[model samples]
Structure formats: C-alpha cells, structure tokens
Target: EDQVTQSPEALRLQEGESSSLNCSYTVSGLRGLFWYRQDPGKGPEFLFTLYSAGEEKEKERLKATLTKKESFLHITAPKPEDSATYLCAVQAGGDSGYSTLTFGKGTMLLVSP
Candidate 1:
C-alpha cells in the first residue's frame, strides 16, 4: 500500500518566519512526488513535481525537495498571504490504466502579521 504522512499538522508563525513541513511516504514502484497548496474550500494548486531522489523545485517563497523516503516543503520568510494548507502526494503503480495520487492530510499554516 502507498501511504503519506505529514507532520506538524498545524503551524502558527509571525510574519518573516521560516519553517519546513515534512512528508514521509511508502510506495511501490515510485513514480512521482507532488506538492500543492490549497486554500480553505478550494482545490489544490500544483507547486512542484519531483520524479527522483535529490530532485527539487521552487517557486516564490516555497521550495520542495525529495529523497528516497520523504519530501520536504520549505517556506522562507513567509508572510500572511503565504498562509495555507500545504499538501504532499505520491504517485505509485496502480492496479490498471493510470496511477493516482496518495495524498497526505496536509499541514496547515497560519502566518500572522
């Protein structure tokens, strides 16, 4: 079975604070690791796609890095506008056709001014 676990389920930070969220997983025939940011009552917006160990991607204030068994989402100098739920998902082999993402619950962040 494929599984993902995210730590520090909820975080509270002041403006200019920096922190990193963790996502650990177990998958068979690992295909891809994806990171997304989702707002309350909204769908997730893609952030990065990592296909192999040591892969990384970054955008704005967020950086995502992948390893053999886990992935990390690093947030730098976050502002209130950057507060959101960060999600990590992994794609592994499926029973048929196309594979699907096994997503972690998510890490909710609140940045205060």
Candidate 2:
C-alpha cells in the first residue's frame, strides 16, 4: 500500500531554534515527493518538489530532501512567523501517465517568540 506518515504530529520551537521533521512513506512507485506549508484558513503553499532519492531543495529557512522510503524537512533558525502546518504529499506514478497525490496528516509547528 502507498501511504505517508509524518512524525511528532506537532512541534514547538523557540525563535532561532532549529529542528528536522520527518515524513515516512510506502508506495509501489514514486513519481515525486512534495512539501507544503498551510496557514490557517488557507490552502497549502508549495515548498519543494523532490524528484528522486538524494535530491534536495531549500527556501528561506527551510530545506526538503527525499529518499527511497521517506522525505525530510529541515528548519534552520526558525522564527515565530514560521509557524504553520507542514504537509508531505506523494505522487504515485502508475501506468496512467499521470499521478495523484496522497497526503500526510501534516505537522503543526508553533514557534514562540
């Protein structure tokens, strides 16, 4: 079965604190792994697209990486404004030539000032 699981469910960090979040997945075939940030009352904001194992992408204070079985989002010197729900989604590549996303529950982050 293809599925995604994110750990820690929720995280609390102080301003300037750094941490790494994990996303575990199981799938028959992987097309891509995606990372997103969702703010309250809004849709998820795209963060990164990892095409294969060992590939990584980064933004302001975030970095995302992928492997054969899982992906990771690393936060560096986080700020209060960085607080949000981090989501992990997977695109399954079957014979259809296209794919659909299977999303994880998400990791809610709280950064205290």
Candidate 3:
C-alpha cells in the first residue's frame, strides 16, 4: 500500500522566519509527488509536481524538492498570510489516468507578526 507521512503536525513561525517541512512517502513505483496548500475552510490548492528525483519547484515563498523517498517544502521569509496547512501527496504507478492520490494529514503552519 502507498503511504505518506508528514513531520511536525503543527508549526509556529514568526513573520519572517523561514523553515522547512518534511514529507516521507513509501510507495511502489512512484510516479509523481505533489505539494499543496490548504486554508482553513477551502480545498487544497496545487503548488508543485515533481516527477523524478532531484527535481525542485518554487513559487513565491515556497520551494518544494523531491527525492527517491521523500519531499521537502521550504518556506522562506514567510508572512502572516502564509499560514495554512501544507499537504503532500503521491501518485503511484498503476493505471495511469485512473490512479487516486494518497495524501498526508498535512502540517499546519501558523505565522505570527
């Protein structure tokens, strides 16, 4: 079975503090790694997609990097508005277009000004 786990269920950061969250995954024939951000009451918003090891993607204050067994999301000089839950999911090898994503519970980030 495919599985994803995130460390530090919750994080508290000062307005300009930078940090990185860990996402560990175990799956057979990993196809893709995806990063997403979710607000309190809204659905997760897509952030990045990593198809192979050594790949990285970035946007705004966030950067996501992928490896063979895990992914990292680095938040740089985050702002108060960056407070939200960060989710990591994986697409495993199987039926290409019909595979469902397996998501971690997510790490909740709280930024204080």
Put down candidate 2 lDDT per residue, 3-106, tens digits, no spaces: 99999899999999999999999977898899999999999999999989999899999999888988999999999999999999999886776799999999
Provide the global lDDT of candidate 2 against the true structure. Answer: 0.93
- Clashing residue pairs in candidate 2 are none
Model 3 misses residue 78 by how many Å?
Answer: 0.5
Worst 10 residues of 3 by lDDT: 91-100
Clashes of 3: 0
Q: lDDT of all the models against the reference?
A: 0.94, 0.93, 0.93
The regions of model 3 sitting more than 4 angstroms off are 95-97
The residue-by-residue lDDT of candidate 3 on 1-113, one tens digit each, is 89999988999999999999999999988889999999999999999999999999999999999999999999999999999999999998765655679999999999999
Candidate 3, after superposition: displacement of residue 84 in Å?
0.4
Looking at candidate 1, what is the lDDT of residue 79? Answer: 95
